[model samples]
Target chain A: MSGASDRVPLPYLREAAVALRDTQQRRNLATATTTIRAKRAAVTAEMPDWEALRVAGAAIKAHTLANLGHYLERLEERVMAAGGHVHWARGAREANDLVRGLVRGTGAREVIKVKSMTTDEIGLNRALAEDGVRAIETDLAELIVQLAGEAPSHILVPAIHKNRAEIRTLFLRAFGIAPSDLSDDPAELAGAARRYLRERFLATGVAVSGANFAVAETGSVCVVESEGNGRMCTTLPHTLISVMGIEKVLPRWRDLEVFLQLLPRSSTAERMNPYTSFWTGVHDGDGPRAFHLVLLDNGRSRTLSDDVGRETLRCIRCSACLNVCPVYERVGGHAYGSVYPGPIGAILNPQLRDVERDEALPYASTLCGACFEVCPVAIDIPRILVELRHRTVERKRERSPLPYGSAEDAAMVGAAKVFARWSRYEAAQRLGRLGQGPFVRDGAIRSLPGPLAGWSAVRDLRALPRQTFREWWRARGAGGGATPGEHEGEARDG
Target chain B: MAESARNAVLAAIERATHQVRDADPAAAHDALTRGYRQRGGASLPECLERLEERLEDYGVRVTRTTADGLPAAVAAWVAERGVQRWVVPPGVPEVWLSSVRGVEAIADDAGPRELDGADAVVTSCAVAVAETGSIVLDAGPGQGRRAATLVPDVHLCVVPASLVVELVPEAVAGLADAVTGGRPLTWISGPSATSDIELVRVAGVHGPRTLAVLLVEDA
Candidate 1:
């Protein structure tokens, strides 16, 4: 199993963020996120009981997570009773090896895959490739990313960063088609993908998937998808192996109703996705005769230990948080340097890995509260980010100072000392007012010198007033004359 | 190895439970039952109407007929599409396909490759949700193996009026036996479609592009 520490270091994430400030990437992210946001608003507004449903969704998840060990035990028993084999993997490497072994047992060297973030998280394809097995991604977006030799940038739409023209060029280049003959139309690209993948689907004897929801009572695994690729992979293959994070288990089948409604609207902004396939273990010659379920714990147990951090497990991977996140919109997913991106990634990666390795992730957010509002499970993402930030600071404080302890840390300590007493605070403010003369122009500081330069480079800061509020109040004689309540109001305004 | 991994993770979970305190199982179950509505306030006929309209909205051709007219409707459905070969799963009644002309109904014992060779597939649905315009196939008598409906390029599903319900909950309730019986269920809303490219809705991808649902009403 691989830990979150497998991620690129903090400096890599910072460098990626700096490099991805290109206007083209910004335009792509802006257009895609804005479109999804509008669509989500329209569909969610159609439901009169949307709020009630969200509350129910959160309750069900909380109840499930509180007793995950119990539910997972029940789920294992049920799946085995239904004639399916269950495997427990404590880490990503073990999960990948287990799946590869299953495919090898079937004597097949190739397997078709459904669009699963779990598979990506485990790096299953790369692992399989090392063992001389071919793992073909059948989802159109996934296929596009695979052909372009690029990582998926978005959760729902992996190729969200790529436009139609780039896809057209990629298809033609990868599939040996003449560029002059291929069109950039989406339909044409979809047709080309269908033609390319249909043969692989029919020929492959093994299929791998990730479950959207696994019901413990009925031993059923549900996969929600818009494209038909999932159906082909789940139905036609002789062997099926599904790798799921243990967090995806629900207690009963009836609980599916809450998630079915919440997932479609929140993810794709649709009343229902085009297809949702559910299969228990194996039916008599109906679907795959051999079924395997891998329950992965890789770092989840550690995450569950933190009361405040455990809520991250309730996430359904709907990508609703990603679409509404302003920081994600600007920096894009690649900058996060984790399979899980956006607000959920901000807290999740740091917990899954250690806070020190993914330290920069917590600061990637602006705490705008858009992600929290859009989350179907009502994860207070801003609160979690703040908590993670606190943890990061505490970790920093515990470490001995080396070449640098961070300039911001020194500034914060200095401000804390100044805020301890009123006279010292007022004097510091007066000194700040006088020192702003050189940098201040047209009442705004466009750029700053020395340590503060990085902050002002991207944004403008307004200069301090000539007189402090206390000075103005003393000059007016209003502080001593006004009542306490009225003085409080004036202080609040100031 | 698997047992050791399981033990290690379970030990971790048990340790965490001690730190935060696990809720009682009974209390958690009670809290999970939220007061979500089972059915939208629509009449039976109104629900059925919405199902047809919604399916059609996604480009599925829906035809309504009584049991007596089902045979002819099936014949016309096959003939209009100019299908020369079609396969019917095991449980579909012989009477439904008897009137169909100029088409051969492939045997249920046929392999998936043989099923794929056919132009279309005809099967009866276990349950249909009226509110969502979705059909549930539980591999019941009429619905053969899951691959029967999936392998063919065109699918014509029969949903009896008796089986049509107003909401997802009602449809789920109707399938308690199938659920516990351990049969596979596929809930199809429309023809297999994709919004993968630019989030544009495209009708035909991997599943049957042409889906025509035959709503057989009792005479």
Candidate 2:
């Protein structure tokens, strides 16, 4: 069985910083993100009431989460009444064990898998492998990642890190395609994947899936996707096991109206996705004779306890935040070392794994608020990032010997104290100018001697002004703020 | 083992969120302001227009037919597409396949391999969404097993005008009973497609690569 809690590798910053130098990775990310960004914008613009849909989505999820116990009970009853089995898993190990037992009951040595983040989060493939069952990824991007033996870097596009040429090369090595016969064309590569996985789909007897949404009232599970692989995995198999995070449950089937509009536009930027498969339990001589729904909690209950962090549960896994994240565009997803990455990962990983384990994550963002802008559920990601950062600092403060904390923490505390009072701020401004005398060159501080040096290394930093904003406001007659910079500078003095 | 885990998680959620399970769903739902439109408020002709445009946008081929002409339309399209064999759902109207000649018509009772061997699968839709250009099958009478629509390389979904709705919510509301009754539902919009490779869309992935929708007029 897989471990219950997923712990991210702690070198997020170092690896991401290193990856920033790979011009090719940067180019791949920039091109992919830009294309998705433009498409999302165009589709969003087409719907005049997009914001209304977002608000409705957030409200529905909030209501579902609030009454989760009732819905869970109701869903269990309905699914069981419909001749399907329901297994509740407190964490990943329980989920994996349940799935393994079910698959074993079917006597299947291999299974086809739909693209699911929850499966990745729980390391389900590894657990299946331990049981001598091979789980093949059918999504083209996921297939590429599986062949390359790399963790998914992006949620929507798992192989977004690789360009056409790299994928062509990987396909040549992995799929046994002759090098000269393969080209760096996307359509050609996709055709090769379709040909390769089609046989597996026809052969596999068991399918393991992760749900996009599970309607409580209907006892139904929904898997939305662009590729038909999800359909193949869900339909062809005789036995189907769906492992879903508890937070994925929705109160009603009609609630899909709001999500359907929000998810496709927010995720793939399509008016509608290619296929959305929804199955309620097992059918008589139809698809999947046996159906199993595993409700997985993992660390979600812990996350739900935090008022500020709980909004992470509202996420639909659309990855709109990732496409717009500046940091994600530069460093890519591998650096996060979590199934989830980008702006959502920065806040979500820390909460799922807790602040102490993934402390470096909350600091991964510049708090640009682009993620919040595009979030379909109106998650307020920037606010959560700040809250997680505060939680991280608090934990550090409690762990450290000094009341204030480390050198960087001490500097922040000192700055806060000075900023709390106007006289202290002016005094500090004067002190900063005087202290920068040694480092100042050509009206800028090109580099610093100590901890602050890291900031200036990547970009030129302008020297501290000779006069503070308070001084400038005073000279501009304080209230006379008609000039352009006068009002903005005066606002800063507040 | 399962019950205890289920209870534990439920208890944890209740304790952490401080929310009881007894909240009245109707009251909560009533309080919610679903600021979005329930329907596109388009005329039938307008909706059909929008549906055709949206379907075409997704690379689906949209064909029109009268109540009495559906079989001929289906047959002609199958012939034009060079389909030598096709499968029909058990509940599909026999009259619709009457004009289909020179091609073997198989039953839905076939296995996935047999279905996959067919050139195309034809079935009727439970509902159609105009705004999103979607056809939903709840595995009802005319619609066969989910595999019938999925396994074959081509899907020809016959949507009657009576089943067409102007918005997704309208179509979803119509399926509420089926959804609650535990029927398998599949929503198809165009053919199977993916934009995973460099964010460039390529159609005909894993599901039926070609989707042809026959919009039949209401009797």
Candidate 3:
């Protein structure tokens, strides 16, 4: 919420490069990503019209975001009309404060939470802790992260980096148990988490969550989860506080048709998620007596303003992009160093914060376009990344103005002068081909001695071939008795 | 302290309303309704089409039938699956089951253990969706409580054609009076599924593994 603990302006590119070299992280990521990718492909392939549906889904979100302010107001009014309360927050601090105030009002000293990335983004748990209220994570992976006092690495699976043995250690140390007694089997671990959370769920009077989708027509908030913990959190508590992003609204309950299909397959590669709980306002005596909806803006409006980047808002937080990303797989989620960790985070975090502050993030992608291909909402992520890179470059240029006679400025001016003419361009290319002799080592430039050292640090650059394209063209023309323009025409025809 | 906190939130909402008034409330409301209609909600047939597309996308099988043949079809499905015990929602029409016999039918009010032990659960939907192939289950007489449909391994929901709505707005509008003035509502799209860290697809995580929807035509 505060700028003080916002992501440190550390050298993320350098750190990510180092992390990418870590064999264990790479292995874990490759295995996990490949498996998820295959599963998603298999599931999505079953639908003959998946592509058409994806296009429709993207168009709907784009249209909604274009008229976001109107929809948000409609959502607020509808919720109120349904006897539900709506709270608007400009930023994370306001959102967190609103939630804490609601919890405090309930006279609740502790609260149980369903897995909500929005809460993590706003640092809600930490804020609640500061106010002397304990917030317990009910989701298995989230509980492991909470016990270890770490930020979530992956959006879907928070403690994804930690293996079963590591989880056993965390549970043993945090809850006072023996690791030897805890089995690595998922069922056993899940049973243990269930036992651990049941007491908190039953005892807690207030529950906090993030909504997967909020229907504006009925003012009903829907939460879809694989575990039944969300159902318990939503239904069992005396009061329910749902912190949702402003972009999460669907106009009517029927709009859920597209997303209900898009989300499950893209997220967990499932036909349908296990538990989808929808609640409107409050129930007399069935579930929560009091309900509050905190609509969080927190940089969303800023993201919405950018025509190139606004498509990122359409994300359902499915994490399909993350699962297919080669870059995300190697570095894991922690390397992104944000609550949103993966391909989506890479482009999103930098834009949400000033590009100058989180500058290293935009360059963290390989531009393979896997994320774009699999994205349910059709967010052209690679295009956005390139645009962000241009923005970053412009910001850098603005920050450090080049003097007229400086070497860097002179070189830029000189290049502009030379690039204006075909003769000069051909001369430079010829010289570059001739100049490659010394740097060429067995046809590859493995090391660079100067300013280019950073790029050569991790990857080898290919050596320039002996003949320039112009020279080759000239030689081929001599043999064929054809001019370069003719050769271009022939190439185009072929 | 509790009263003060409530007052503070109420005050905040009041203040927010006065702080920003860029758009006309009526215009904003109309634009939203129109936009929502354009996005996914429209006619019952459109909604049903969307539901069928979504259901097939999610790997759920859907069948269309009339109310008279409903019980016979379900019985055949039960026989095919070798199911011995089937759970039926309390409000399902007597005519729908008039032709079926031999299988044990547990009422919707059956305990969680009883529902869990049944091979299948069949109930009439509070509302049927054509767009998402989803069935809405309010705590109505036939639909039963949330647990009955959820705890069973196989869930077969019957939706009469007349109950289907094209868009979420229609669905919400259809249920508005009931939800605001009547009872608790539940909207279900498909069967339950999950994918673990290994990305292994697992069915029946916390709810039914197989969800079969029979869209019954009105007589």
Q: lDDT per residue, candidate 1, B1-219, as tens digits?
A: 989998888888877666554567646676565666777788768877989998997788999999999999998888888999988777789899989877887876577678778999899988888766788888888887777787788999988888888777677777878888888888888888877677777777877888999998672
Better of 2 and 3 by TM-score: 2
Per-candidate fnat, comma-separated: 0.62, 0.82, 0.12
Q: What are the runs in model 3 whose C-alpha is more than 4 Å off?
A: A1-9, A175-177, A404-494, B1-136, B142-194, B201-219
Per-residue CA lDDT of model 2 for A161-198, tens digit only, reads 88888899888987899988878888888888999899
Show where candidate 1 strays beyond 4 Å: A1-16, A400-409, A416-494, B19-27
Model 1 deviation from the true structure expressed as Cα RMSD, one decimal place: 5.4
Query: Which tens-of-lDDT digit does each residue in B100-200 have in candidate 2?
Result: 88888778878888988999999998999888889999889989888888888999988888888988789888998888787888988899998878888
Per-candidate TM-score against the hidden true structure: 0.90, 0.90, 0.72
Select the stronger candidate by TM-score from 1 and 3: 1
**Residue-level lDDT tens digits of model 3 in A1-494:** 23223445346666677677778767766877787789889878876567866876786676666666656767788777766788877778888888988888888889999899999888898799888898888877778777777767778877666666677777778766677778766656655665676567656889999999887666778898876678768876778899998889876555565677788789877655655677778765456778889887777776776566458888899999999887788788877778787789888888766645477677778999999999998999999889888777666666665655334446678799889999998887678657656676766777776655765766777666555466767788788455556644543332
In order, the first chain's TM-score in every candidate is: 0.86, 0.86, 0.85
Model 1 chain B poorest ten-residue lDDT run: B17-26
DockQ of 2: 0.73
lDDT of 1 at A332: 80
